[model samples]
Target: MKRLIRRMTHLRHSDDQISARVRAVLVESLYASPRSLIIGALTSSAIAAVVAAASGDEWLIGCAVLIGLVGAVRIVDALRMRGSATVRQQERGYRIGALTYAGLLGVFGLLTLTRTDSGVLDLLSVTTAIGYAAGIAGRNAGRPLIALSQLCFASLPLVFGLLLPLDPLKALLAAVILLFVLAMSDITQQTYAVILRATTASEEMAALAEHHAGMARRDDLTGMANRTAFREHFEERLRNLTASGEHLALLWLDLDRFKEVNDFFGHLAGNALLVAVARRLEQVLGDRGIVARLGGDEFAILCGVADARAAGCIGSAMLEAVRQPVGFNGHDLRTTASIGIAIAPDNGRDADTLLKNADLALYRAKEKGRGRFFFYEPLMDEKIERRRQIALAMDGALERNEFELVYQPIFDLAKGRITSCETLLRWNSPQFGSISPAEFIPIAEDNTLIVMIGDWVLRQACRTAAHWPADVTIAVNLSPVQLRAPDLTHAVLAALSASGLPPERLTLEVTESVLLDDVDRSLAALSALNRIHVCTTLDDFGTGYSSLSYLTQFPFQTLKIDRSFVIDLEHNPASVAIVQTIVDLAAKLGMRTVAEGVETPAQLDQLRRTRCDAVQGFLLARPMSAPEVIGLFAEQAAFRSNPGQPALPGAD
Candidate 1:
């Protein structure tokens, strides 16, 4: 019994709390309009006046005066509540006035119905009281307590007065009045529930709309602002800075070798790393700036800075923050970022130009090598224009016959003969005159023109080599972009078939970069070439990570040591050792080794001591035209027949 009492008490308290919430929602409706309040006041005044005049009773006259006062007060309260700001205080006042007025009406009804026997007075008293009770259902329905209170206060006394008569007709009228009050109670409750539901649903819809808007501006993975939000924020900052005469900095950042992480590890790990990096950046910036994840492996920051130097300080801090290794899945995942900064009114005032300039600076930073920052400069625009010009010229250069190939002979150190000639492309544009391959080749690759240009080089080299001795093979360099082409093997076969050059007489060289990304695809392409009996060399060996793994991964016929090591072979004992080690490694693997950029006799002597299979540089011969190569071939043939002449000297 005690537990049941305790539970009932708890339930009653819970119900009280719910009733309080419902009352709060509906309370304003009680004061929504003054028409009902005004009507109640006038009706009370008229009834009191009529009852007092008809009966001429002193006590009833006093009651009439009280009714006038209460009616006037309630009317004034309702009128004053029109534009009131304090809802709680005003609602309390309204409730007090309402109950007071209703109670006075009930007192007057009982006085007129009991003391006065005049038929007209009794009829007016009963009708006025019942009419006021019925009006409470509509007027005070928002607060069911007030509605029900008004119903009882205004009509219960009249019911009592009617029952006091002890007549069947009067008893029936009293019971009908009681039934009317009960019906009004039901109507008031139903109305309150409908209003509450409508208000709650409206509030819920508004909240849902706000949440969706927030999601649209945020990145789903990192919870950082997305590109759309970033641009909007950037424009807002720009506008504010324009007014305040302050400088705003926009920094663009890109993760270096991020794709490798996705390739080596899985994308889930990559996403986690990105999230970790974002948290670090936010912590480093604190409230000093806004960092947004623009897109995959890219982010943008907006901050107020004094100048380029200040921006550089922030960029340095970001670099240090990002350099810290992120721990993921029990391993330390390390990465670095390159930053590009563009300051407002200094780089550009508009958002588009500033963002573009910042991205351009980012490209420059990555180009100079990652893990650094670059400020936007006007010169970058000129360089971009130059690239655009080259891209345009390259589109028609092949058709204009502006491109040609030159062959550089690879001298066999032991055989004392030219074993192979590597094909190099040259472009003498009518517009720009003799652009170096280093400058234009990358631009060509960026624009995807390298594939077309590479195909032409392959065919031309094969045709040129078909005229040379069968022992003299033709070598052509393949860019990573060209290797990624879907029909690379077909292009190679077409070149060989069209030129009538044997597949064994052709060698395709690729750098370790090709094997770095998408290694499976790269290996497949090289394997296809290998299957056709065309030779493949891992060019610029020892310059990339896991060089030995690549050697084991593919059957490369030759390994060309990067010029970086061979260039120092004359004086650096380390370089000699490295070259000797590579030669020994290649010999054990049954692959020939070629040393590039061998210029001096000392370098040559060191390589010879190292037993390098082949050497190609200015020490033996520079690259020459096809005619010069044919002439050199004739001279070599004559020397072979003579058998007593020294080998050809190095060319300038």
Candidate 2:
């Protein structure tokens, strides 16, 4: 009994799961339209008229009247269904009414069969009953149960009445009618299955389309609105705010030093950190605004505010939220964000304009020092336009011969002669003459123009130094962008092979920033250079964190103390101690040291006492053109030959 109850419950649950629309459609198929009902009623009246006229049977006439009444009632019910709450509500009533109509037709047919002896009456009544039963299958197949019930109600009585004659022909006819009823039941079941399958597949397709649309608007990793969706929302909000004259703030957020995290940890850890940060931003903003991940480590926020002060407060909260360290893979990944706020109406109201200005402000924040926010100002646009013009001019600056290399000699403090010259890039554009390296080199790096420019510098420096005295090596600065290039090692080899300069005569100078990005890759590149007998010098030594760790990681031939330490060596005891300590450490590590920016004789003398290997500064020589460098080498050779005169003009 329990098993039976469970099976019945399961069936009921399955039935209840069908959508309401499908159920209504099935019920609607059971009730004919008003026109169809009226036509069916008139047909019944006609059949009754024919039978009663032929047989002169008053009982047949009465049965026909009853059938007509039921038909009229069914027609009235069908008409009412047009404005009904739902077709499903009238399902049971319609089924009963249909069965009644079928039973009355069966009664009329039976009375005709009993009262008439003519073969015509018998044939007409029997044919009408079977025809009505067959017609029910086509009209009511959406509801198989009701269809089958009507079929049996109309046909079974005639089958029983025909069997009462006890004749073989009549029994065969009855058997044929029973067979017709069974075939109709199967037809109804098949038709119902087809309708149900079609309806269900359509519903599933609609739901799947809606799901895909939602996915298109969402970020895959962070599950926030993507760039495209954010833009649309931004435009829509702007439109809504236009008439109200209220201000909306668009905050452009960028994670600072995120690329370093990706380089140190793997990309998976970076992605996990991004997801955590997105959650924090969402939680911090809550219902006050909408946050979107606008690709990479950048995000955007939209909120209504009265002015820049309110926007600044929101930006402050966002910065604090992002400052929280996220734990991943047993390490606390700490990051900070820079925010740029552009207010609507005051900042030109359109999405593209506001976003561009906000991005400009964000760049300014990072430029000044990150972990802060800035509002868009009109002056920023002019500065950005200037930067854009500079970038555009740089695209073909090398091909136009606008770049030149100058050499600054590094003198041996004890030997009192130049040992190496660091090549410095200079841009003398005809459009904007004498652009500083500090301003333009960063612009080049930002646009990836540094890679091509750095390569040229390497080859040119090698070629220039090939003609110099063999004892004097050449140094070329490598940017962090160049180190990440896959062809860095190849570029170095090609430069050496083309210039006919020995690998030992070339020294590649790298700042500590290089090691901070992808330590393994940087070490591999440096190791490849070392294998080829090329020297690597760690420039700006004391400015970076983990300076000692970097020295142990790679085989650097020299450490150049930063100019900040060398400039104050005479007056500041701490600077003197730093220089001495670096000199001692470099000597112990078997690496040479050079003091940069040594101007005063006192600073140079102090460096000499500390046993610094070399010094490069304006005191000895400024960066000079290639021709001047060649002349200086010639002067040194002249001094070597005489053995009496000074090797340099200002030598001690």
Candidate 3:
């Protein structure tokens, strides 16, 4: 757990240095105290000018005039610094002005002592007068170095001038001025520390705020900007386009088979694939535009383009980049992306419209065929709206009992009798009547409705098939979604117990590819089912990831030859060879084989010749209603038969 937290921390932005940022803020704010500094300087110059005139010393009057000149120059520089934007330039100007102010204070202290008849009275007065200007430096304590420097330079000169005179009062006044300078120096340092600490705290807060804002804008899983950031950034890009009317394209991409990845692999594996895809997008596009993960498996890109053809070229490149294979858990997994492009001004003038059009184009690309790209068209929105409505309606279809199960019988070709029946799901919606399983099934799987629907089908099939002959086994397909369910074994057992059916007469068929999702978990679930004597088979056998390894690792009872191979039996020798190979493999492994989509007696004869154990297709029987299932069995007196055993009376 600590390691996972550590990895997550590594992905976040590194924190900024509070002290350095605080320093920059202070330097930029060098003009913060100019008004007070000017007021103190003007007041000091006036008082020193009065003393200079009373003493009748020309040098004292000259010192006050010089101080006034320096004060005026510093105030001017401070104003210029306030107008400047650069921190470094502002800081340089502030330091020069402060030094000049310090120099003027030093000159005033020296001028008071430069008199020839400077007695104990004059010296004591000079020390007391220098103390007033020293207070001005204390007022500028936020600039500690300048404040402390001015105090020390101004007070030390007058104190030393007093020390030169051998008088108790002069020495006492000199010590008092020295004490004043020391106190002011401490106050300046302490005041600066308080200001600096405050600045540090403010900068820390700013940094923390920025970090949180960045987190909100970025996807945690993929390290790409999320939808909010994408919208904001794309709008900014639109605003920045030059008057030459440069074309910009917004490409929306969605992984074609991302759901299959999550189903076949686990979510962790799916997350890893998304991260890899994010990197690939970064590498392919590189600074040409912005690539962001809008949400799960969907991404959006904004890039500069000259025309529609340029956008198409970039979209094609993105498609190929996503098409590359990813390796996870010792398997090379392949996926493709369907991309949609929306050009600025051509598709839509602004961000929201362009994004909607891009998304529409993406759905059209997926609808046409996966692993392709499409440009936005106005009509695509209408088609996608219809699909969106269907998907929404499916959410309540099962609850409303719009779904039903039909059983297609599997016949023993050699013995000429029904061995088992495979359950097929069908949905008849009031809004869209008789939606094909191919259409609605994927939609359900994509939206996670399949798991509930699959569970319902399992229970229904078991309950309906319980009254069938004891020798007959009923097969129902298991979706990968159900296989991932934690309560799958319990659900199956409950269904069997409720239906009063023996586990021996119940079969759960899974696709070979779906079994790859957390293989241990699937195996453990299947193993638990096996303990109750339920039969397991790998259905649509040769269609995906056909590995002999799974056949051995899993206790699959049958390998159903896919319809594709069966249909090509008379025309394609390779299909025939493949079927023969699977049949021979199944036999040697102590498993049965069932050929699917057998529509002709010739195909059945060919399957029988190949020694395939059973056949299922329209030729034997179409999927029938539950009552029709009973009627056919009663009319035909269908009995389970084993080819290896001697044929009993009325077996065919």
Candidate 4:
């Protein structure tokens, strides 16, 4: 008896385990079979309806099956068009489903009224209507429309049955109940659809915002962060590095002679060169640090390095990267960059200070002759401060008319008389005394103050020369920066018109370096000046490349021999040969030659023998104020009037 009992207990346990496994399999199948939902609902409802009709006593079963069939069809249609429904179509579907549900509930209520007692039908109708009302309220995720729809649907069934009972109140109540059920089902589906649409819109908006932000930070030309973004990122990194005891280096790079390229070629070619330069920089430094376009041929890099040497290596790499030729607009162009390196904790702790220090270092590198890098030093900061003070003082000096011009006489060798005077700029700063032209000219050129200063010199020279004999011409040196100004031609015309000096009496001396900078533009400017009949002289000839070529290409009236050759002519045979060759070449070109810095009589004699057209030095007369020059000439004229004069020894 005990064994039989134990066997029965084991069988029972086995049965329970099998039942649990079957239920798990059924649940998994149902979830995975999405199409089976509509299929199963329709099939079940059809089978139930057919069975009820054949039995003839199951009207309630038929009605329930019909309701299930209609619900299944609507859900399946919604699923079928889920990926293809237009917004308007989707809204229309919601309305159709709502009205269908209402019709179905009304039909079910009518069936109940025909079979059950009046009281029973009324109660069933009210209960079904309440369920429909709740479903509508829950639809649209608790939107006010859902609650209003529910309230209207719920009240309709009771009110219709009470007011308009043509045959029986129960029948009307049943119809109203059926309508309420369908409305609730429609509300539920519409609410789910609305939630999905809203979610999609939010996600799309977020993505668009992210895209715009990315564009805002990036430079369009180089695809690198722009100056504004660079500053923000640089500051953040600096703060982090400061806390971590790490060092950072900032390199400010400026392309040497980039403007020459732009002037020679068109701006399109210039833009192409810039793009190619950006690519080279990216290839060289992108892996190690951050690079940014600080605008107009200037690029900045932020590097994390252990020491200054490593930072230097990176800078050297960058220089080499840009040295390669970039082909643009059918021309192979070459360029080089001057870099300034400023180390954190050594140069400064913040972005502005570091950037300023790097820029100063860059200036030093350029002054040392480009294609090199310099680390910021204490002395550099001192020089920068001094320049700033000088620039400020220069600004005030212009307003106070502290700048003055001194005339150095250019004597005609054949006539042995002063034929013209070259105007030399002199700055007597109240704060710092005498500032060298070599020092201040470059500063002025860079800051664009040269334009103002150049204009002042032109007006002053013309005004002062007007006081001298009309036969004596006045020569003014023009800085290359001033020549390249867009309004340069206009400015010259205005100065001539205002000063009342004949263009024929004015001589403009330009360096060969200016021609090399932009041969075409320089020629154009020279041609314009020549059209006005101004004498154009090639200043400091033989010192720059392509001098002889420039002499033939442009319409120059004179060649001023550089003082270097003149100073060593007495000592160096080669120097004398070079001077003689230049003089001969000038004669061949039909341009007069002037020898500057003639000190001794022997030097003057040698220059005369070379057949140089003119000479200027302390040996003849030093640079003097306008009045001093007029006084010297007056004294010489008086000496000539006295007989014996020896004819003033060739002073005609």
| Residue 169 miss distance in model 4 (angstroms) | 16
Alpha-carbon shift of residue 73 in model 2 (angstroms)? 16
If scored against the real structure, what TM-score would every candidate get?
A: 0.64, 0.64, 0.71, 0.65
**Candidate 4 error regions (>4 Å):** 1-215, 220-223, 240-247, 256-276, 304-336, 345-349, 392-402, 484-494, 546-554, 569-578, 600-611, 643-652
lDDT for each residue of candidate 2 in 568-642, tens digit (9 for 90 to 100) = 987899999999999999999999998889787788888889999999998888999989998988877787788
The best candidate by TM-score is: 3
Flag the better candidate by lDDT, 2 or 3: 2
- Kindly report which residue stretches of model 3 are placed more than 4 angstroms away from their true locations once superposed: 1-18, 28-30, 44-65, 82-89, 112-132, 135-137, 160-171, 241-243, 259-268, 327-334, 407-422, 430-434, 469-624, 632-652
Residues 322-416 of candidate 4 have per-residue lDDT tens digits of: 88888886787777899999999778999999999998899888878789999999799888778777877887688887788899988888776
In candidate 3, what are the lDDT values of residues 1-652, reduced to their tens digit?
Answer: 2432342243222212335577677665556767866776676666666667767788877877887787788767766666645655665667666666666666666666667464543544464456554664556555555555566656677777767766788789789887776666666566766777887788889999999999999999988889999989999988887768689999999987687677667898898889988999888888998999998889998899888998898888888888788898897667889898999978877898998898788877877756899999888888788777789999889889999999998878666667688899999999989988988876776567888898899889999888887778899988776776767888899898889988999999988878764577788878888888999989888887746888878888889899999999988899899999999999999999998998876787788789999888887788999998888677455333334533322223
Q: Report each candidate's C-alpha RMSD, comma-separated, in the order given.
A: 7.9, 7.9, 9.6, 15.0
Flag clash pairs in model 3.
Answer: none
Kindly report which residue pairs in candidate 2 clash with one another.
none
The better-scoring model by TM-score among 2 and 3 is 3
Assess candidate 3 and give its lDDT: 0.78
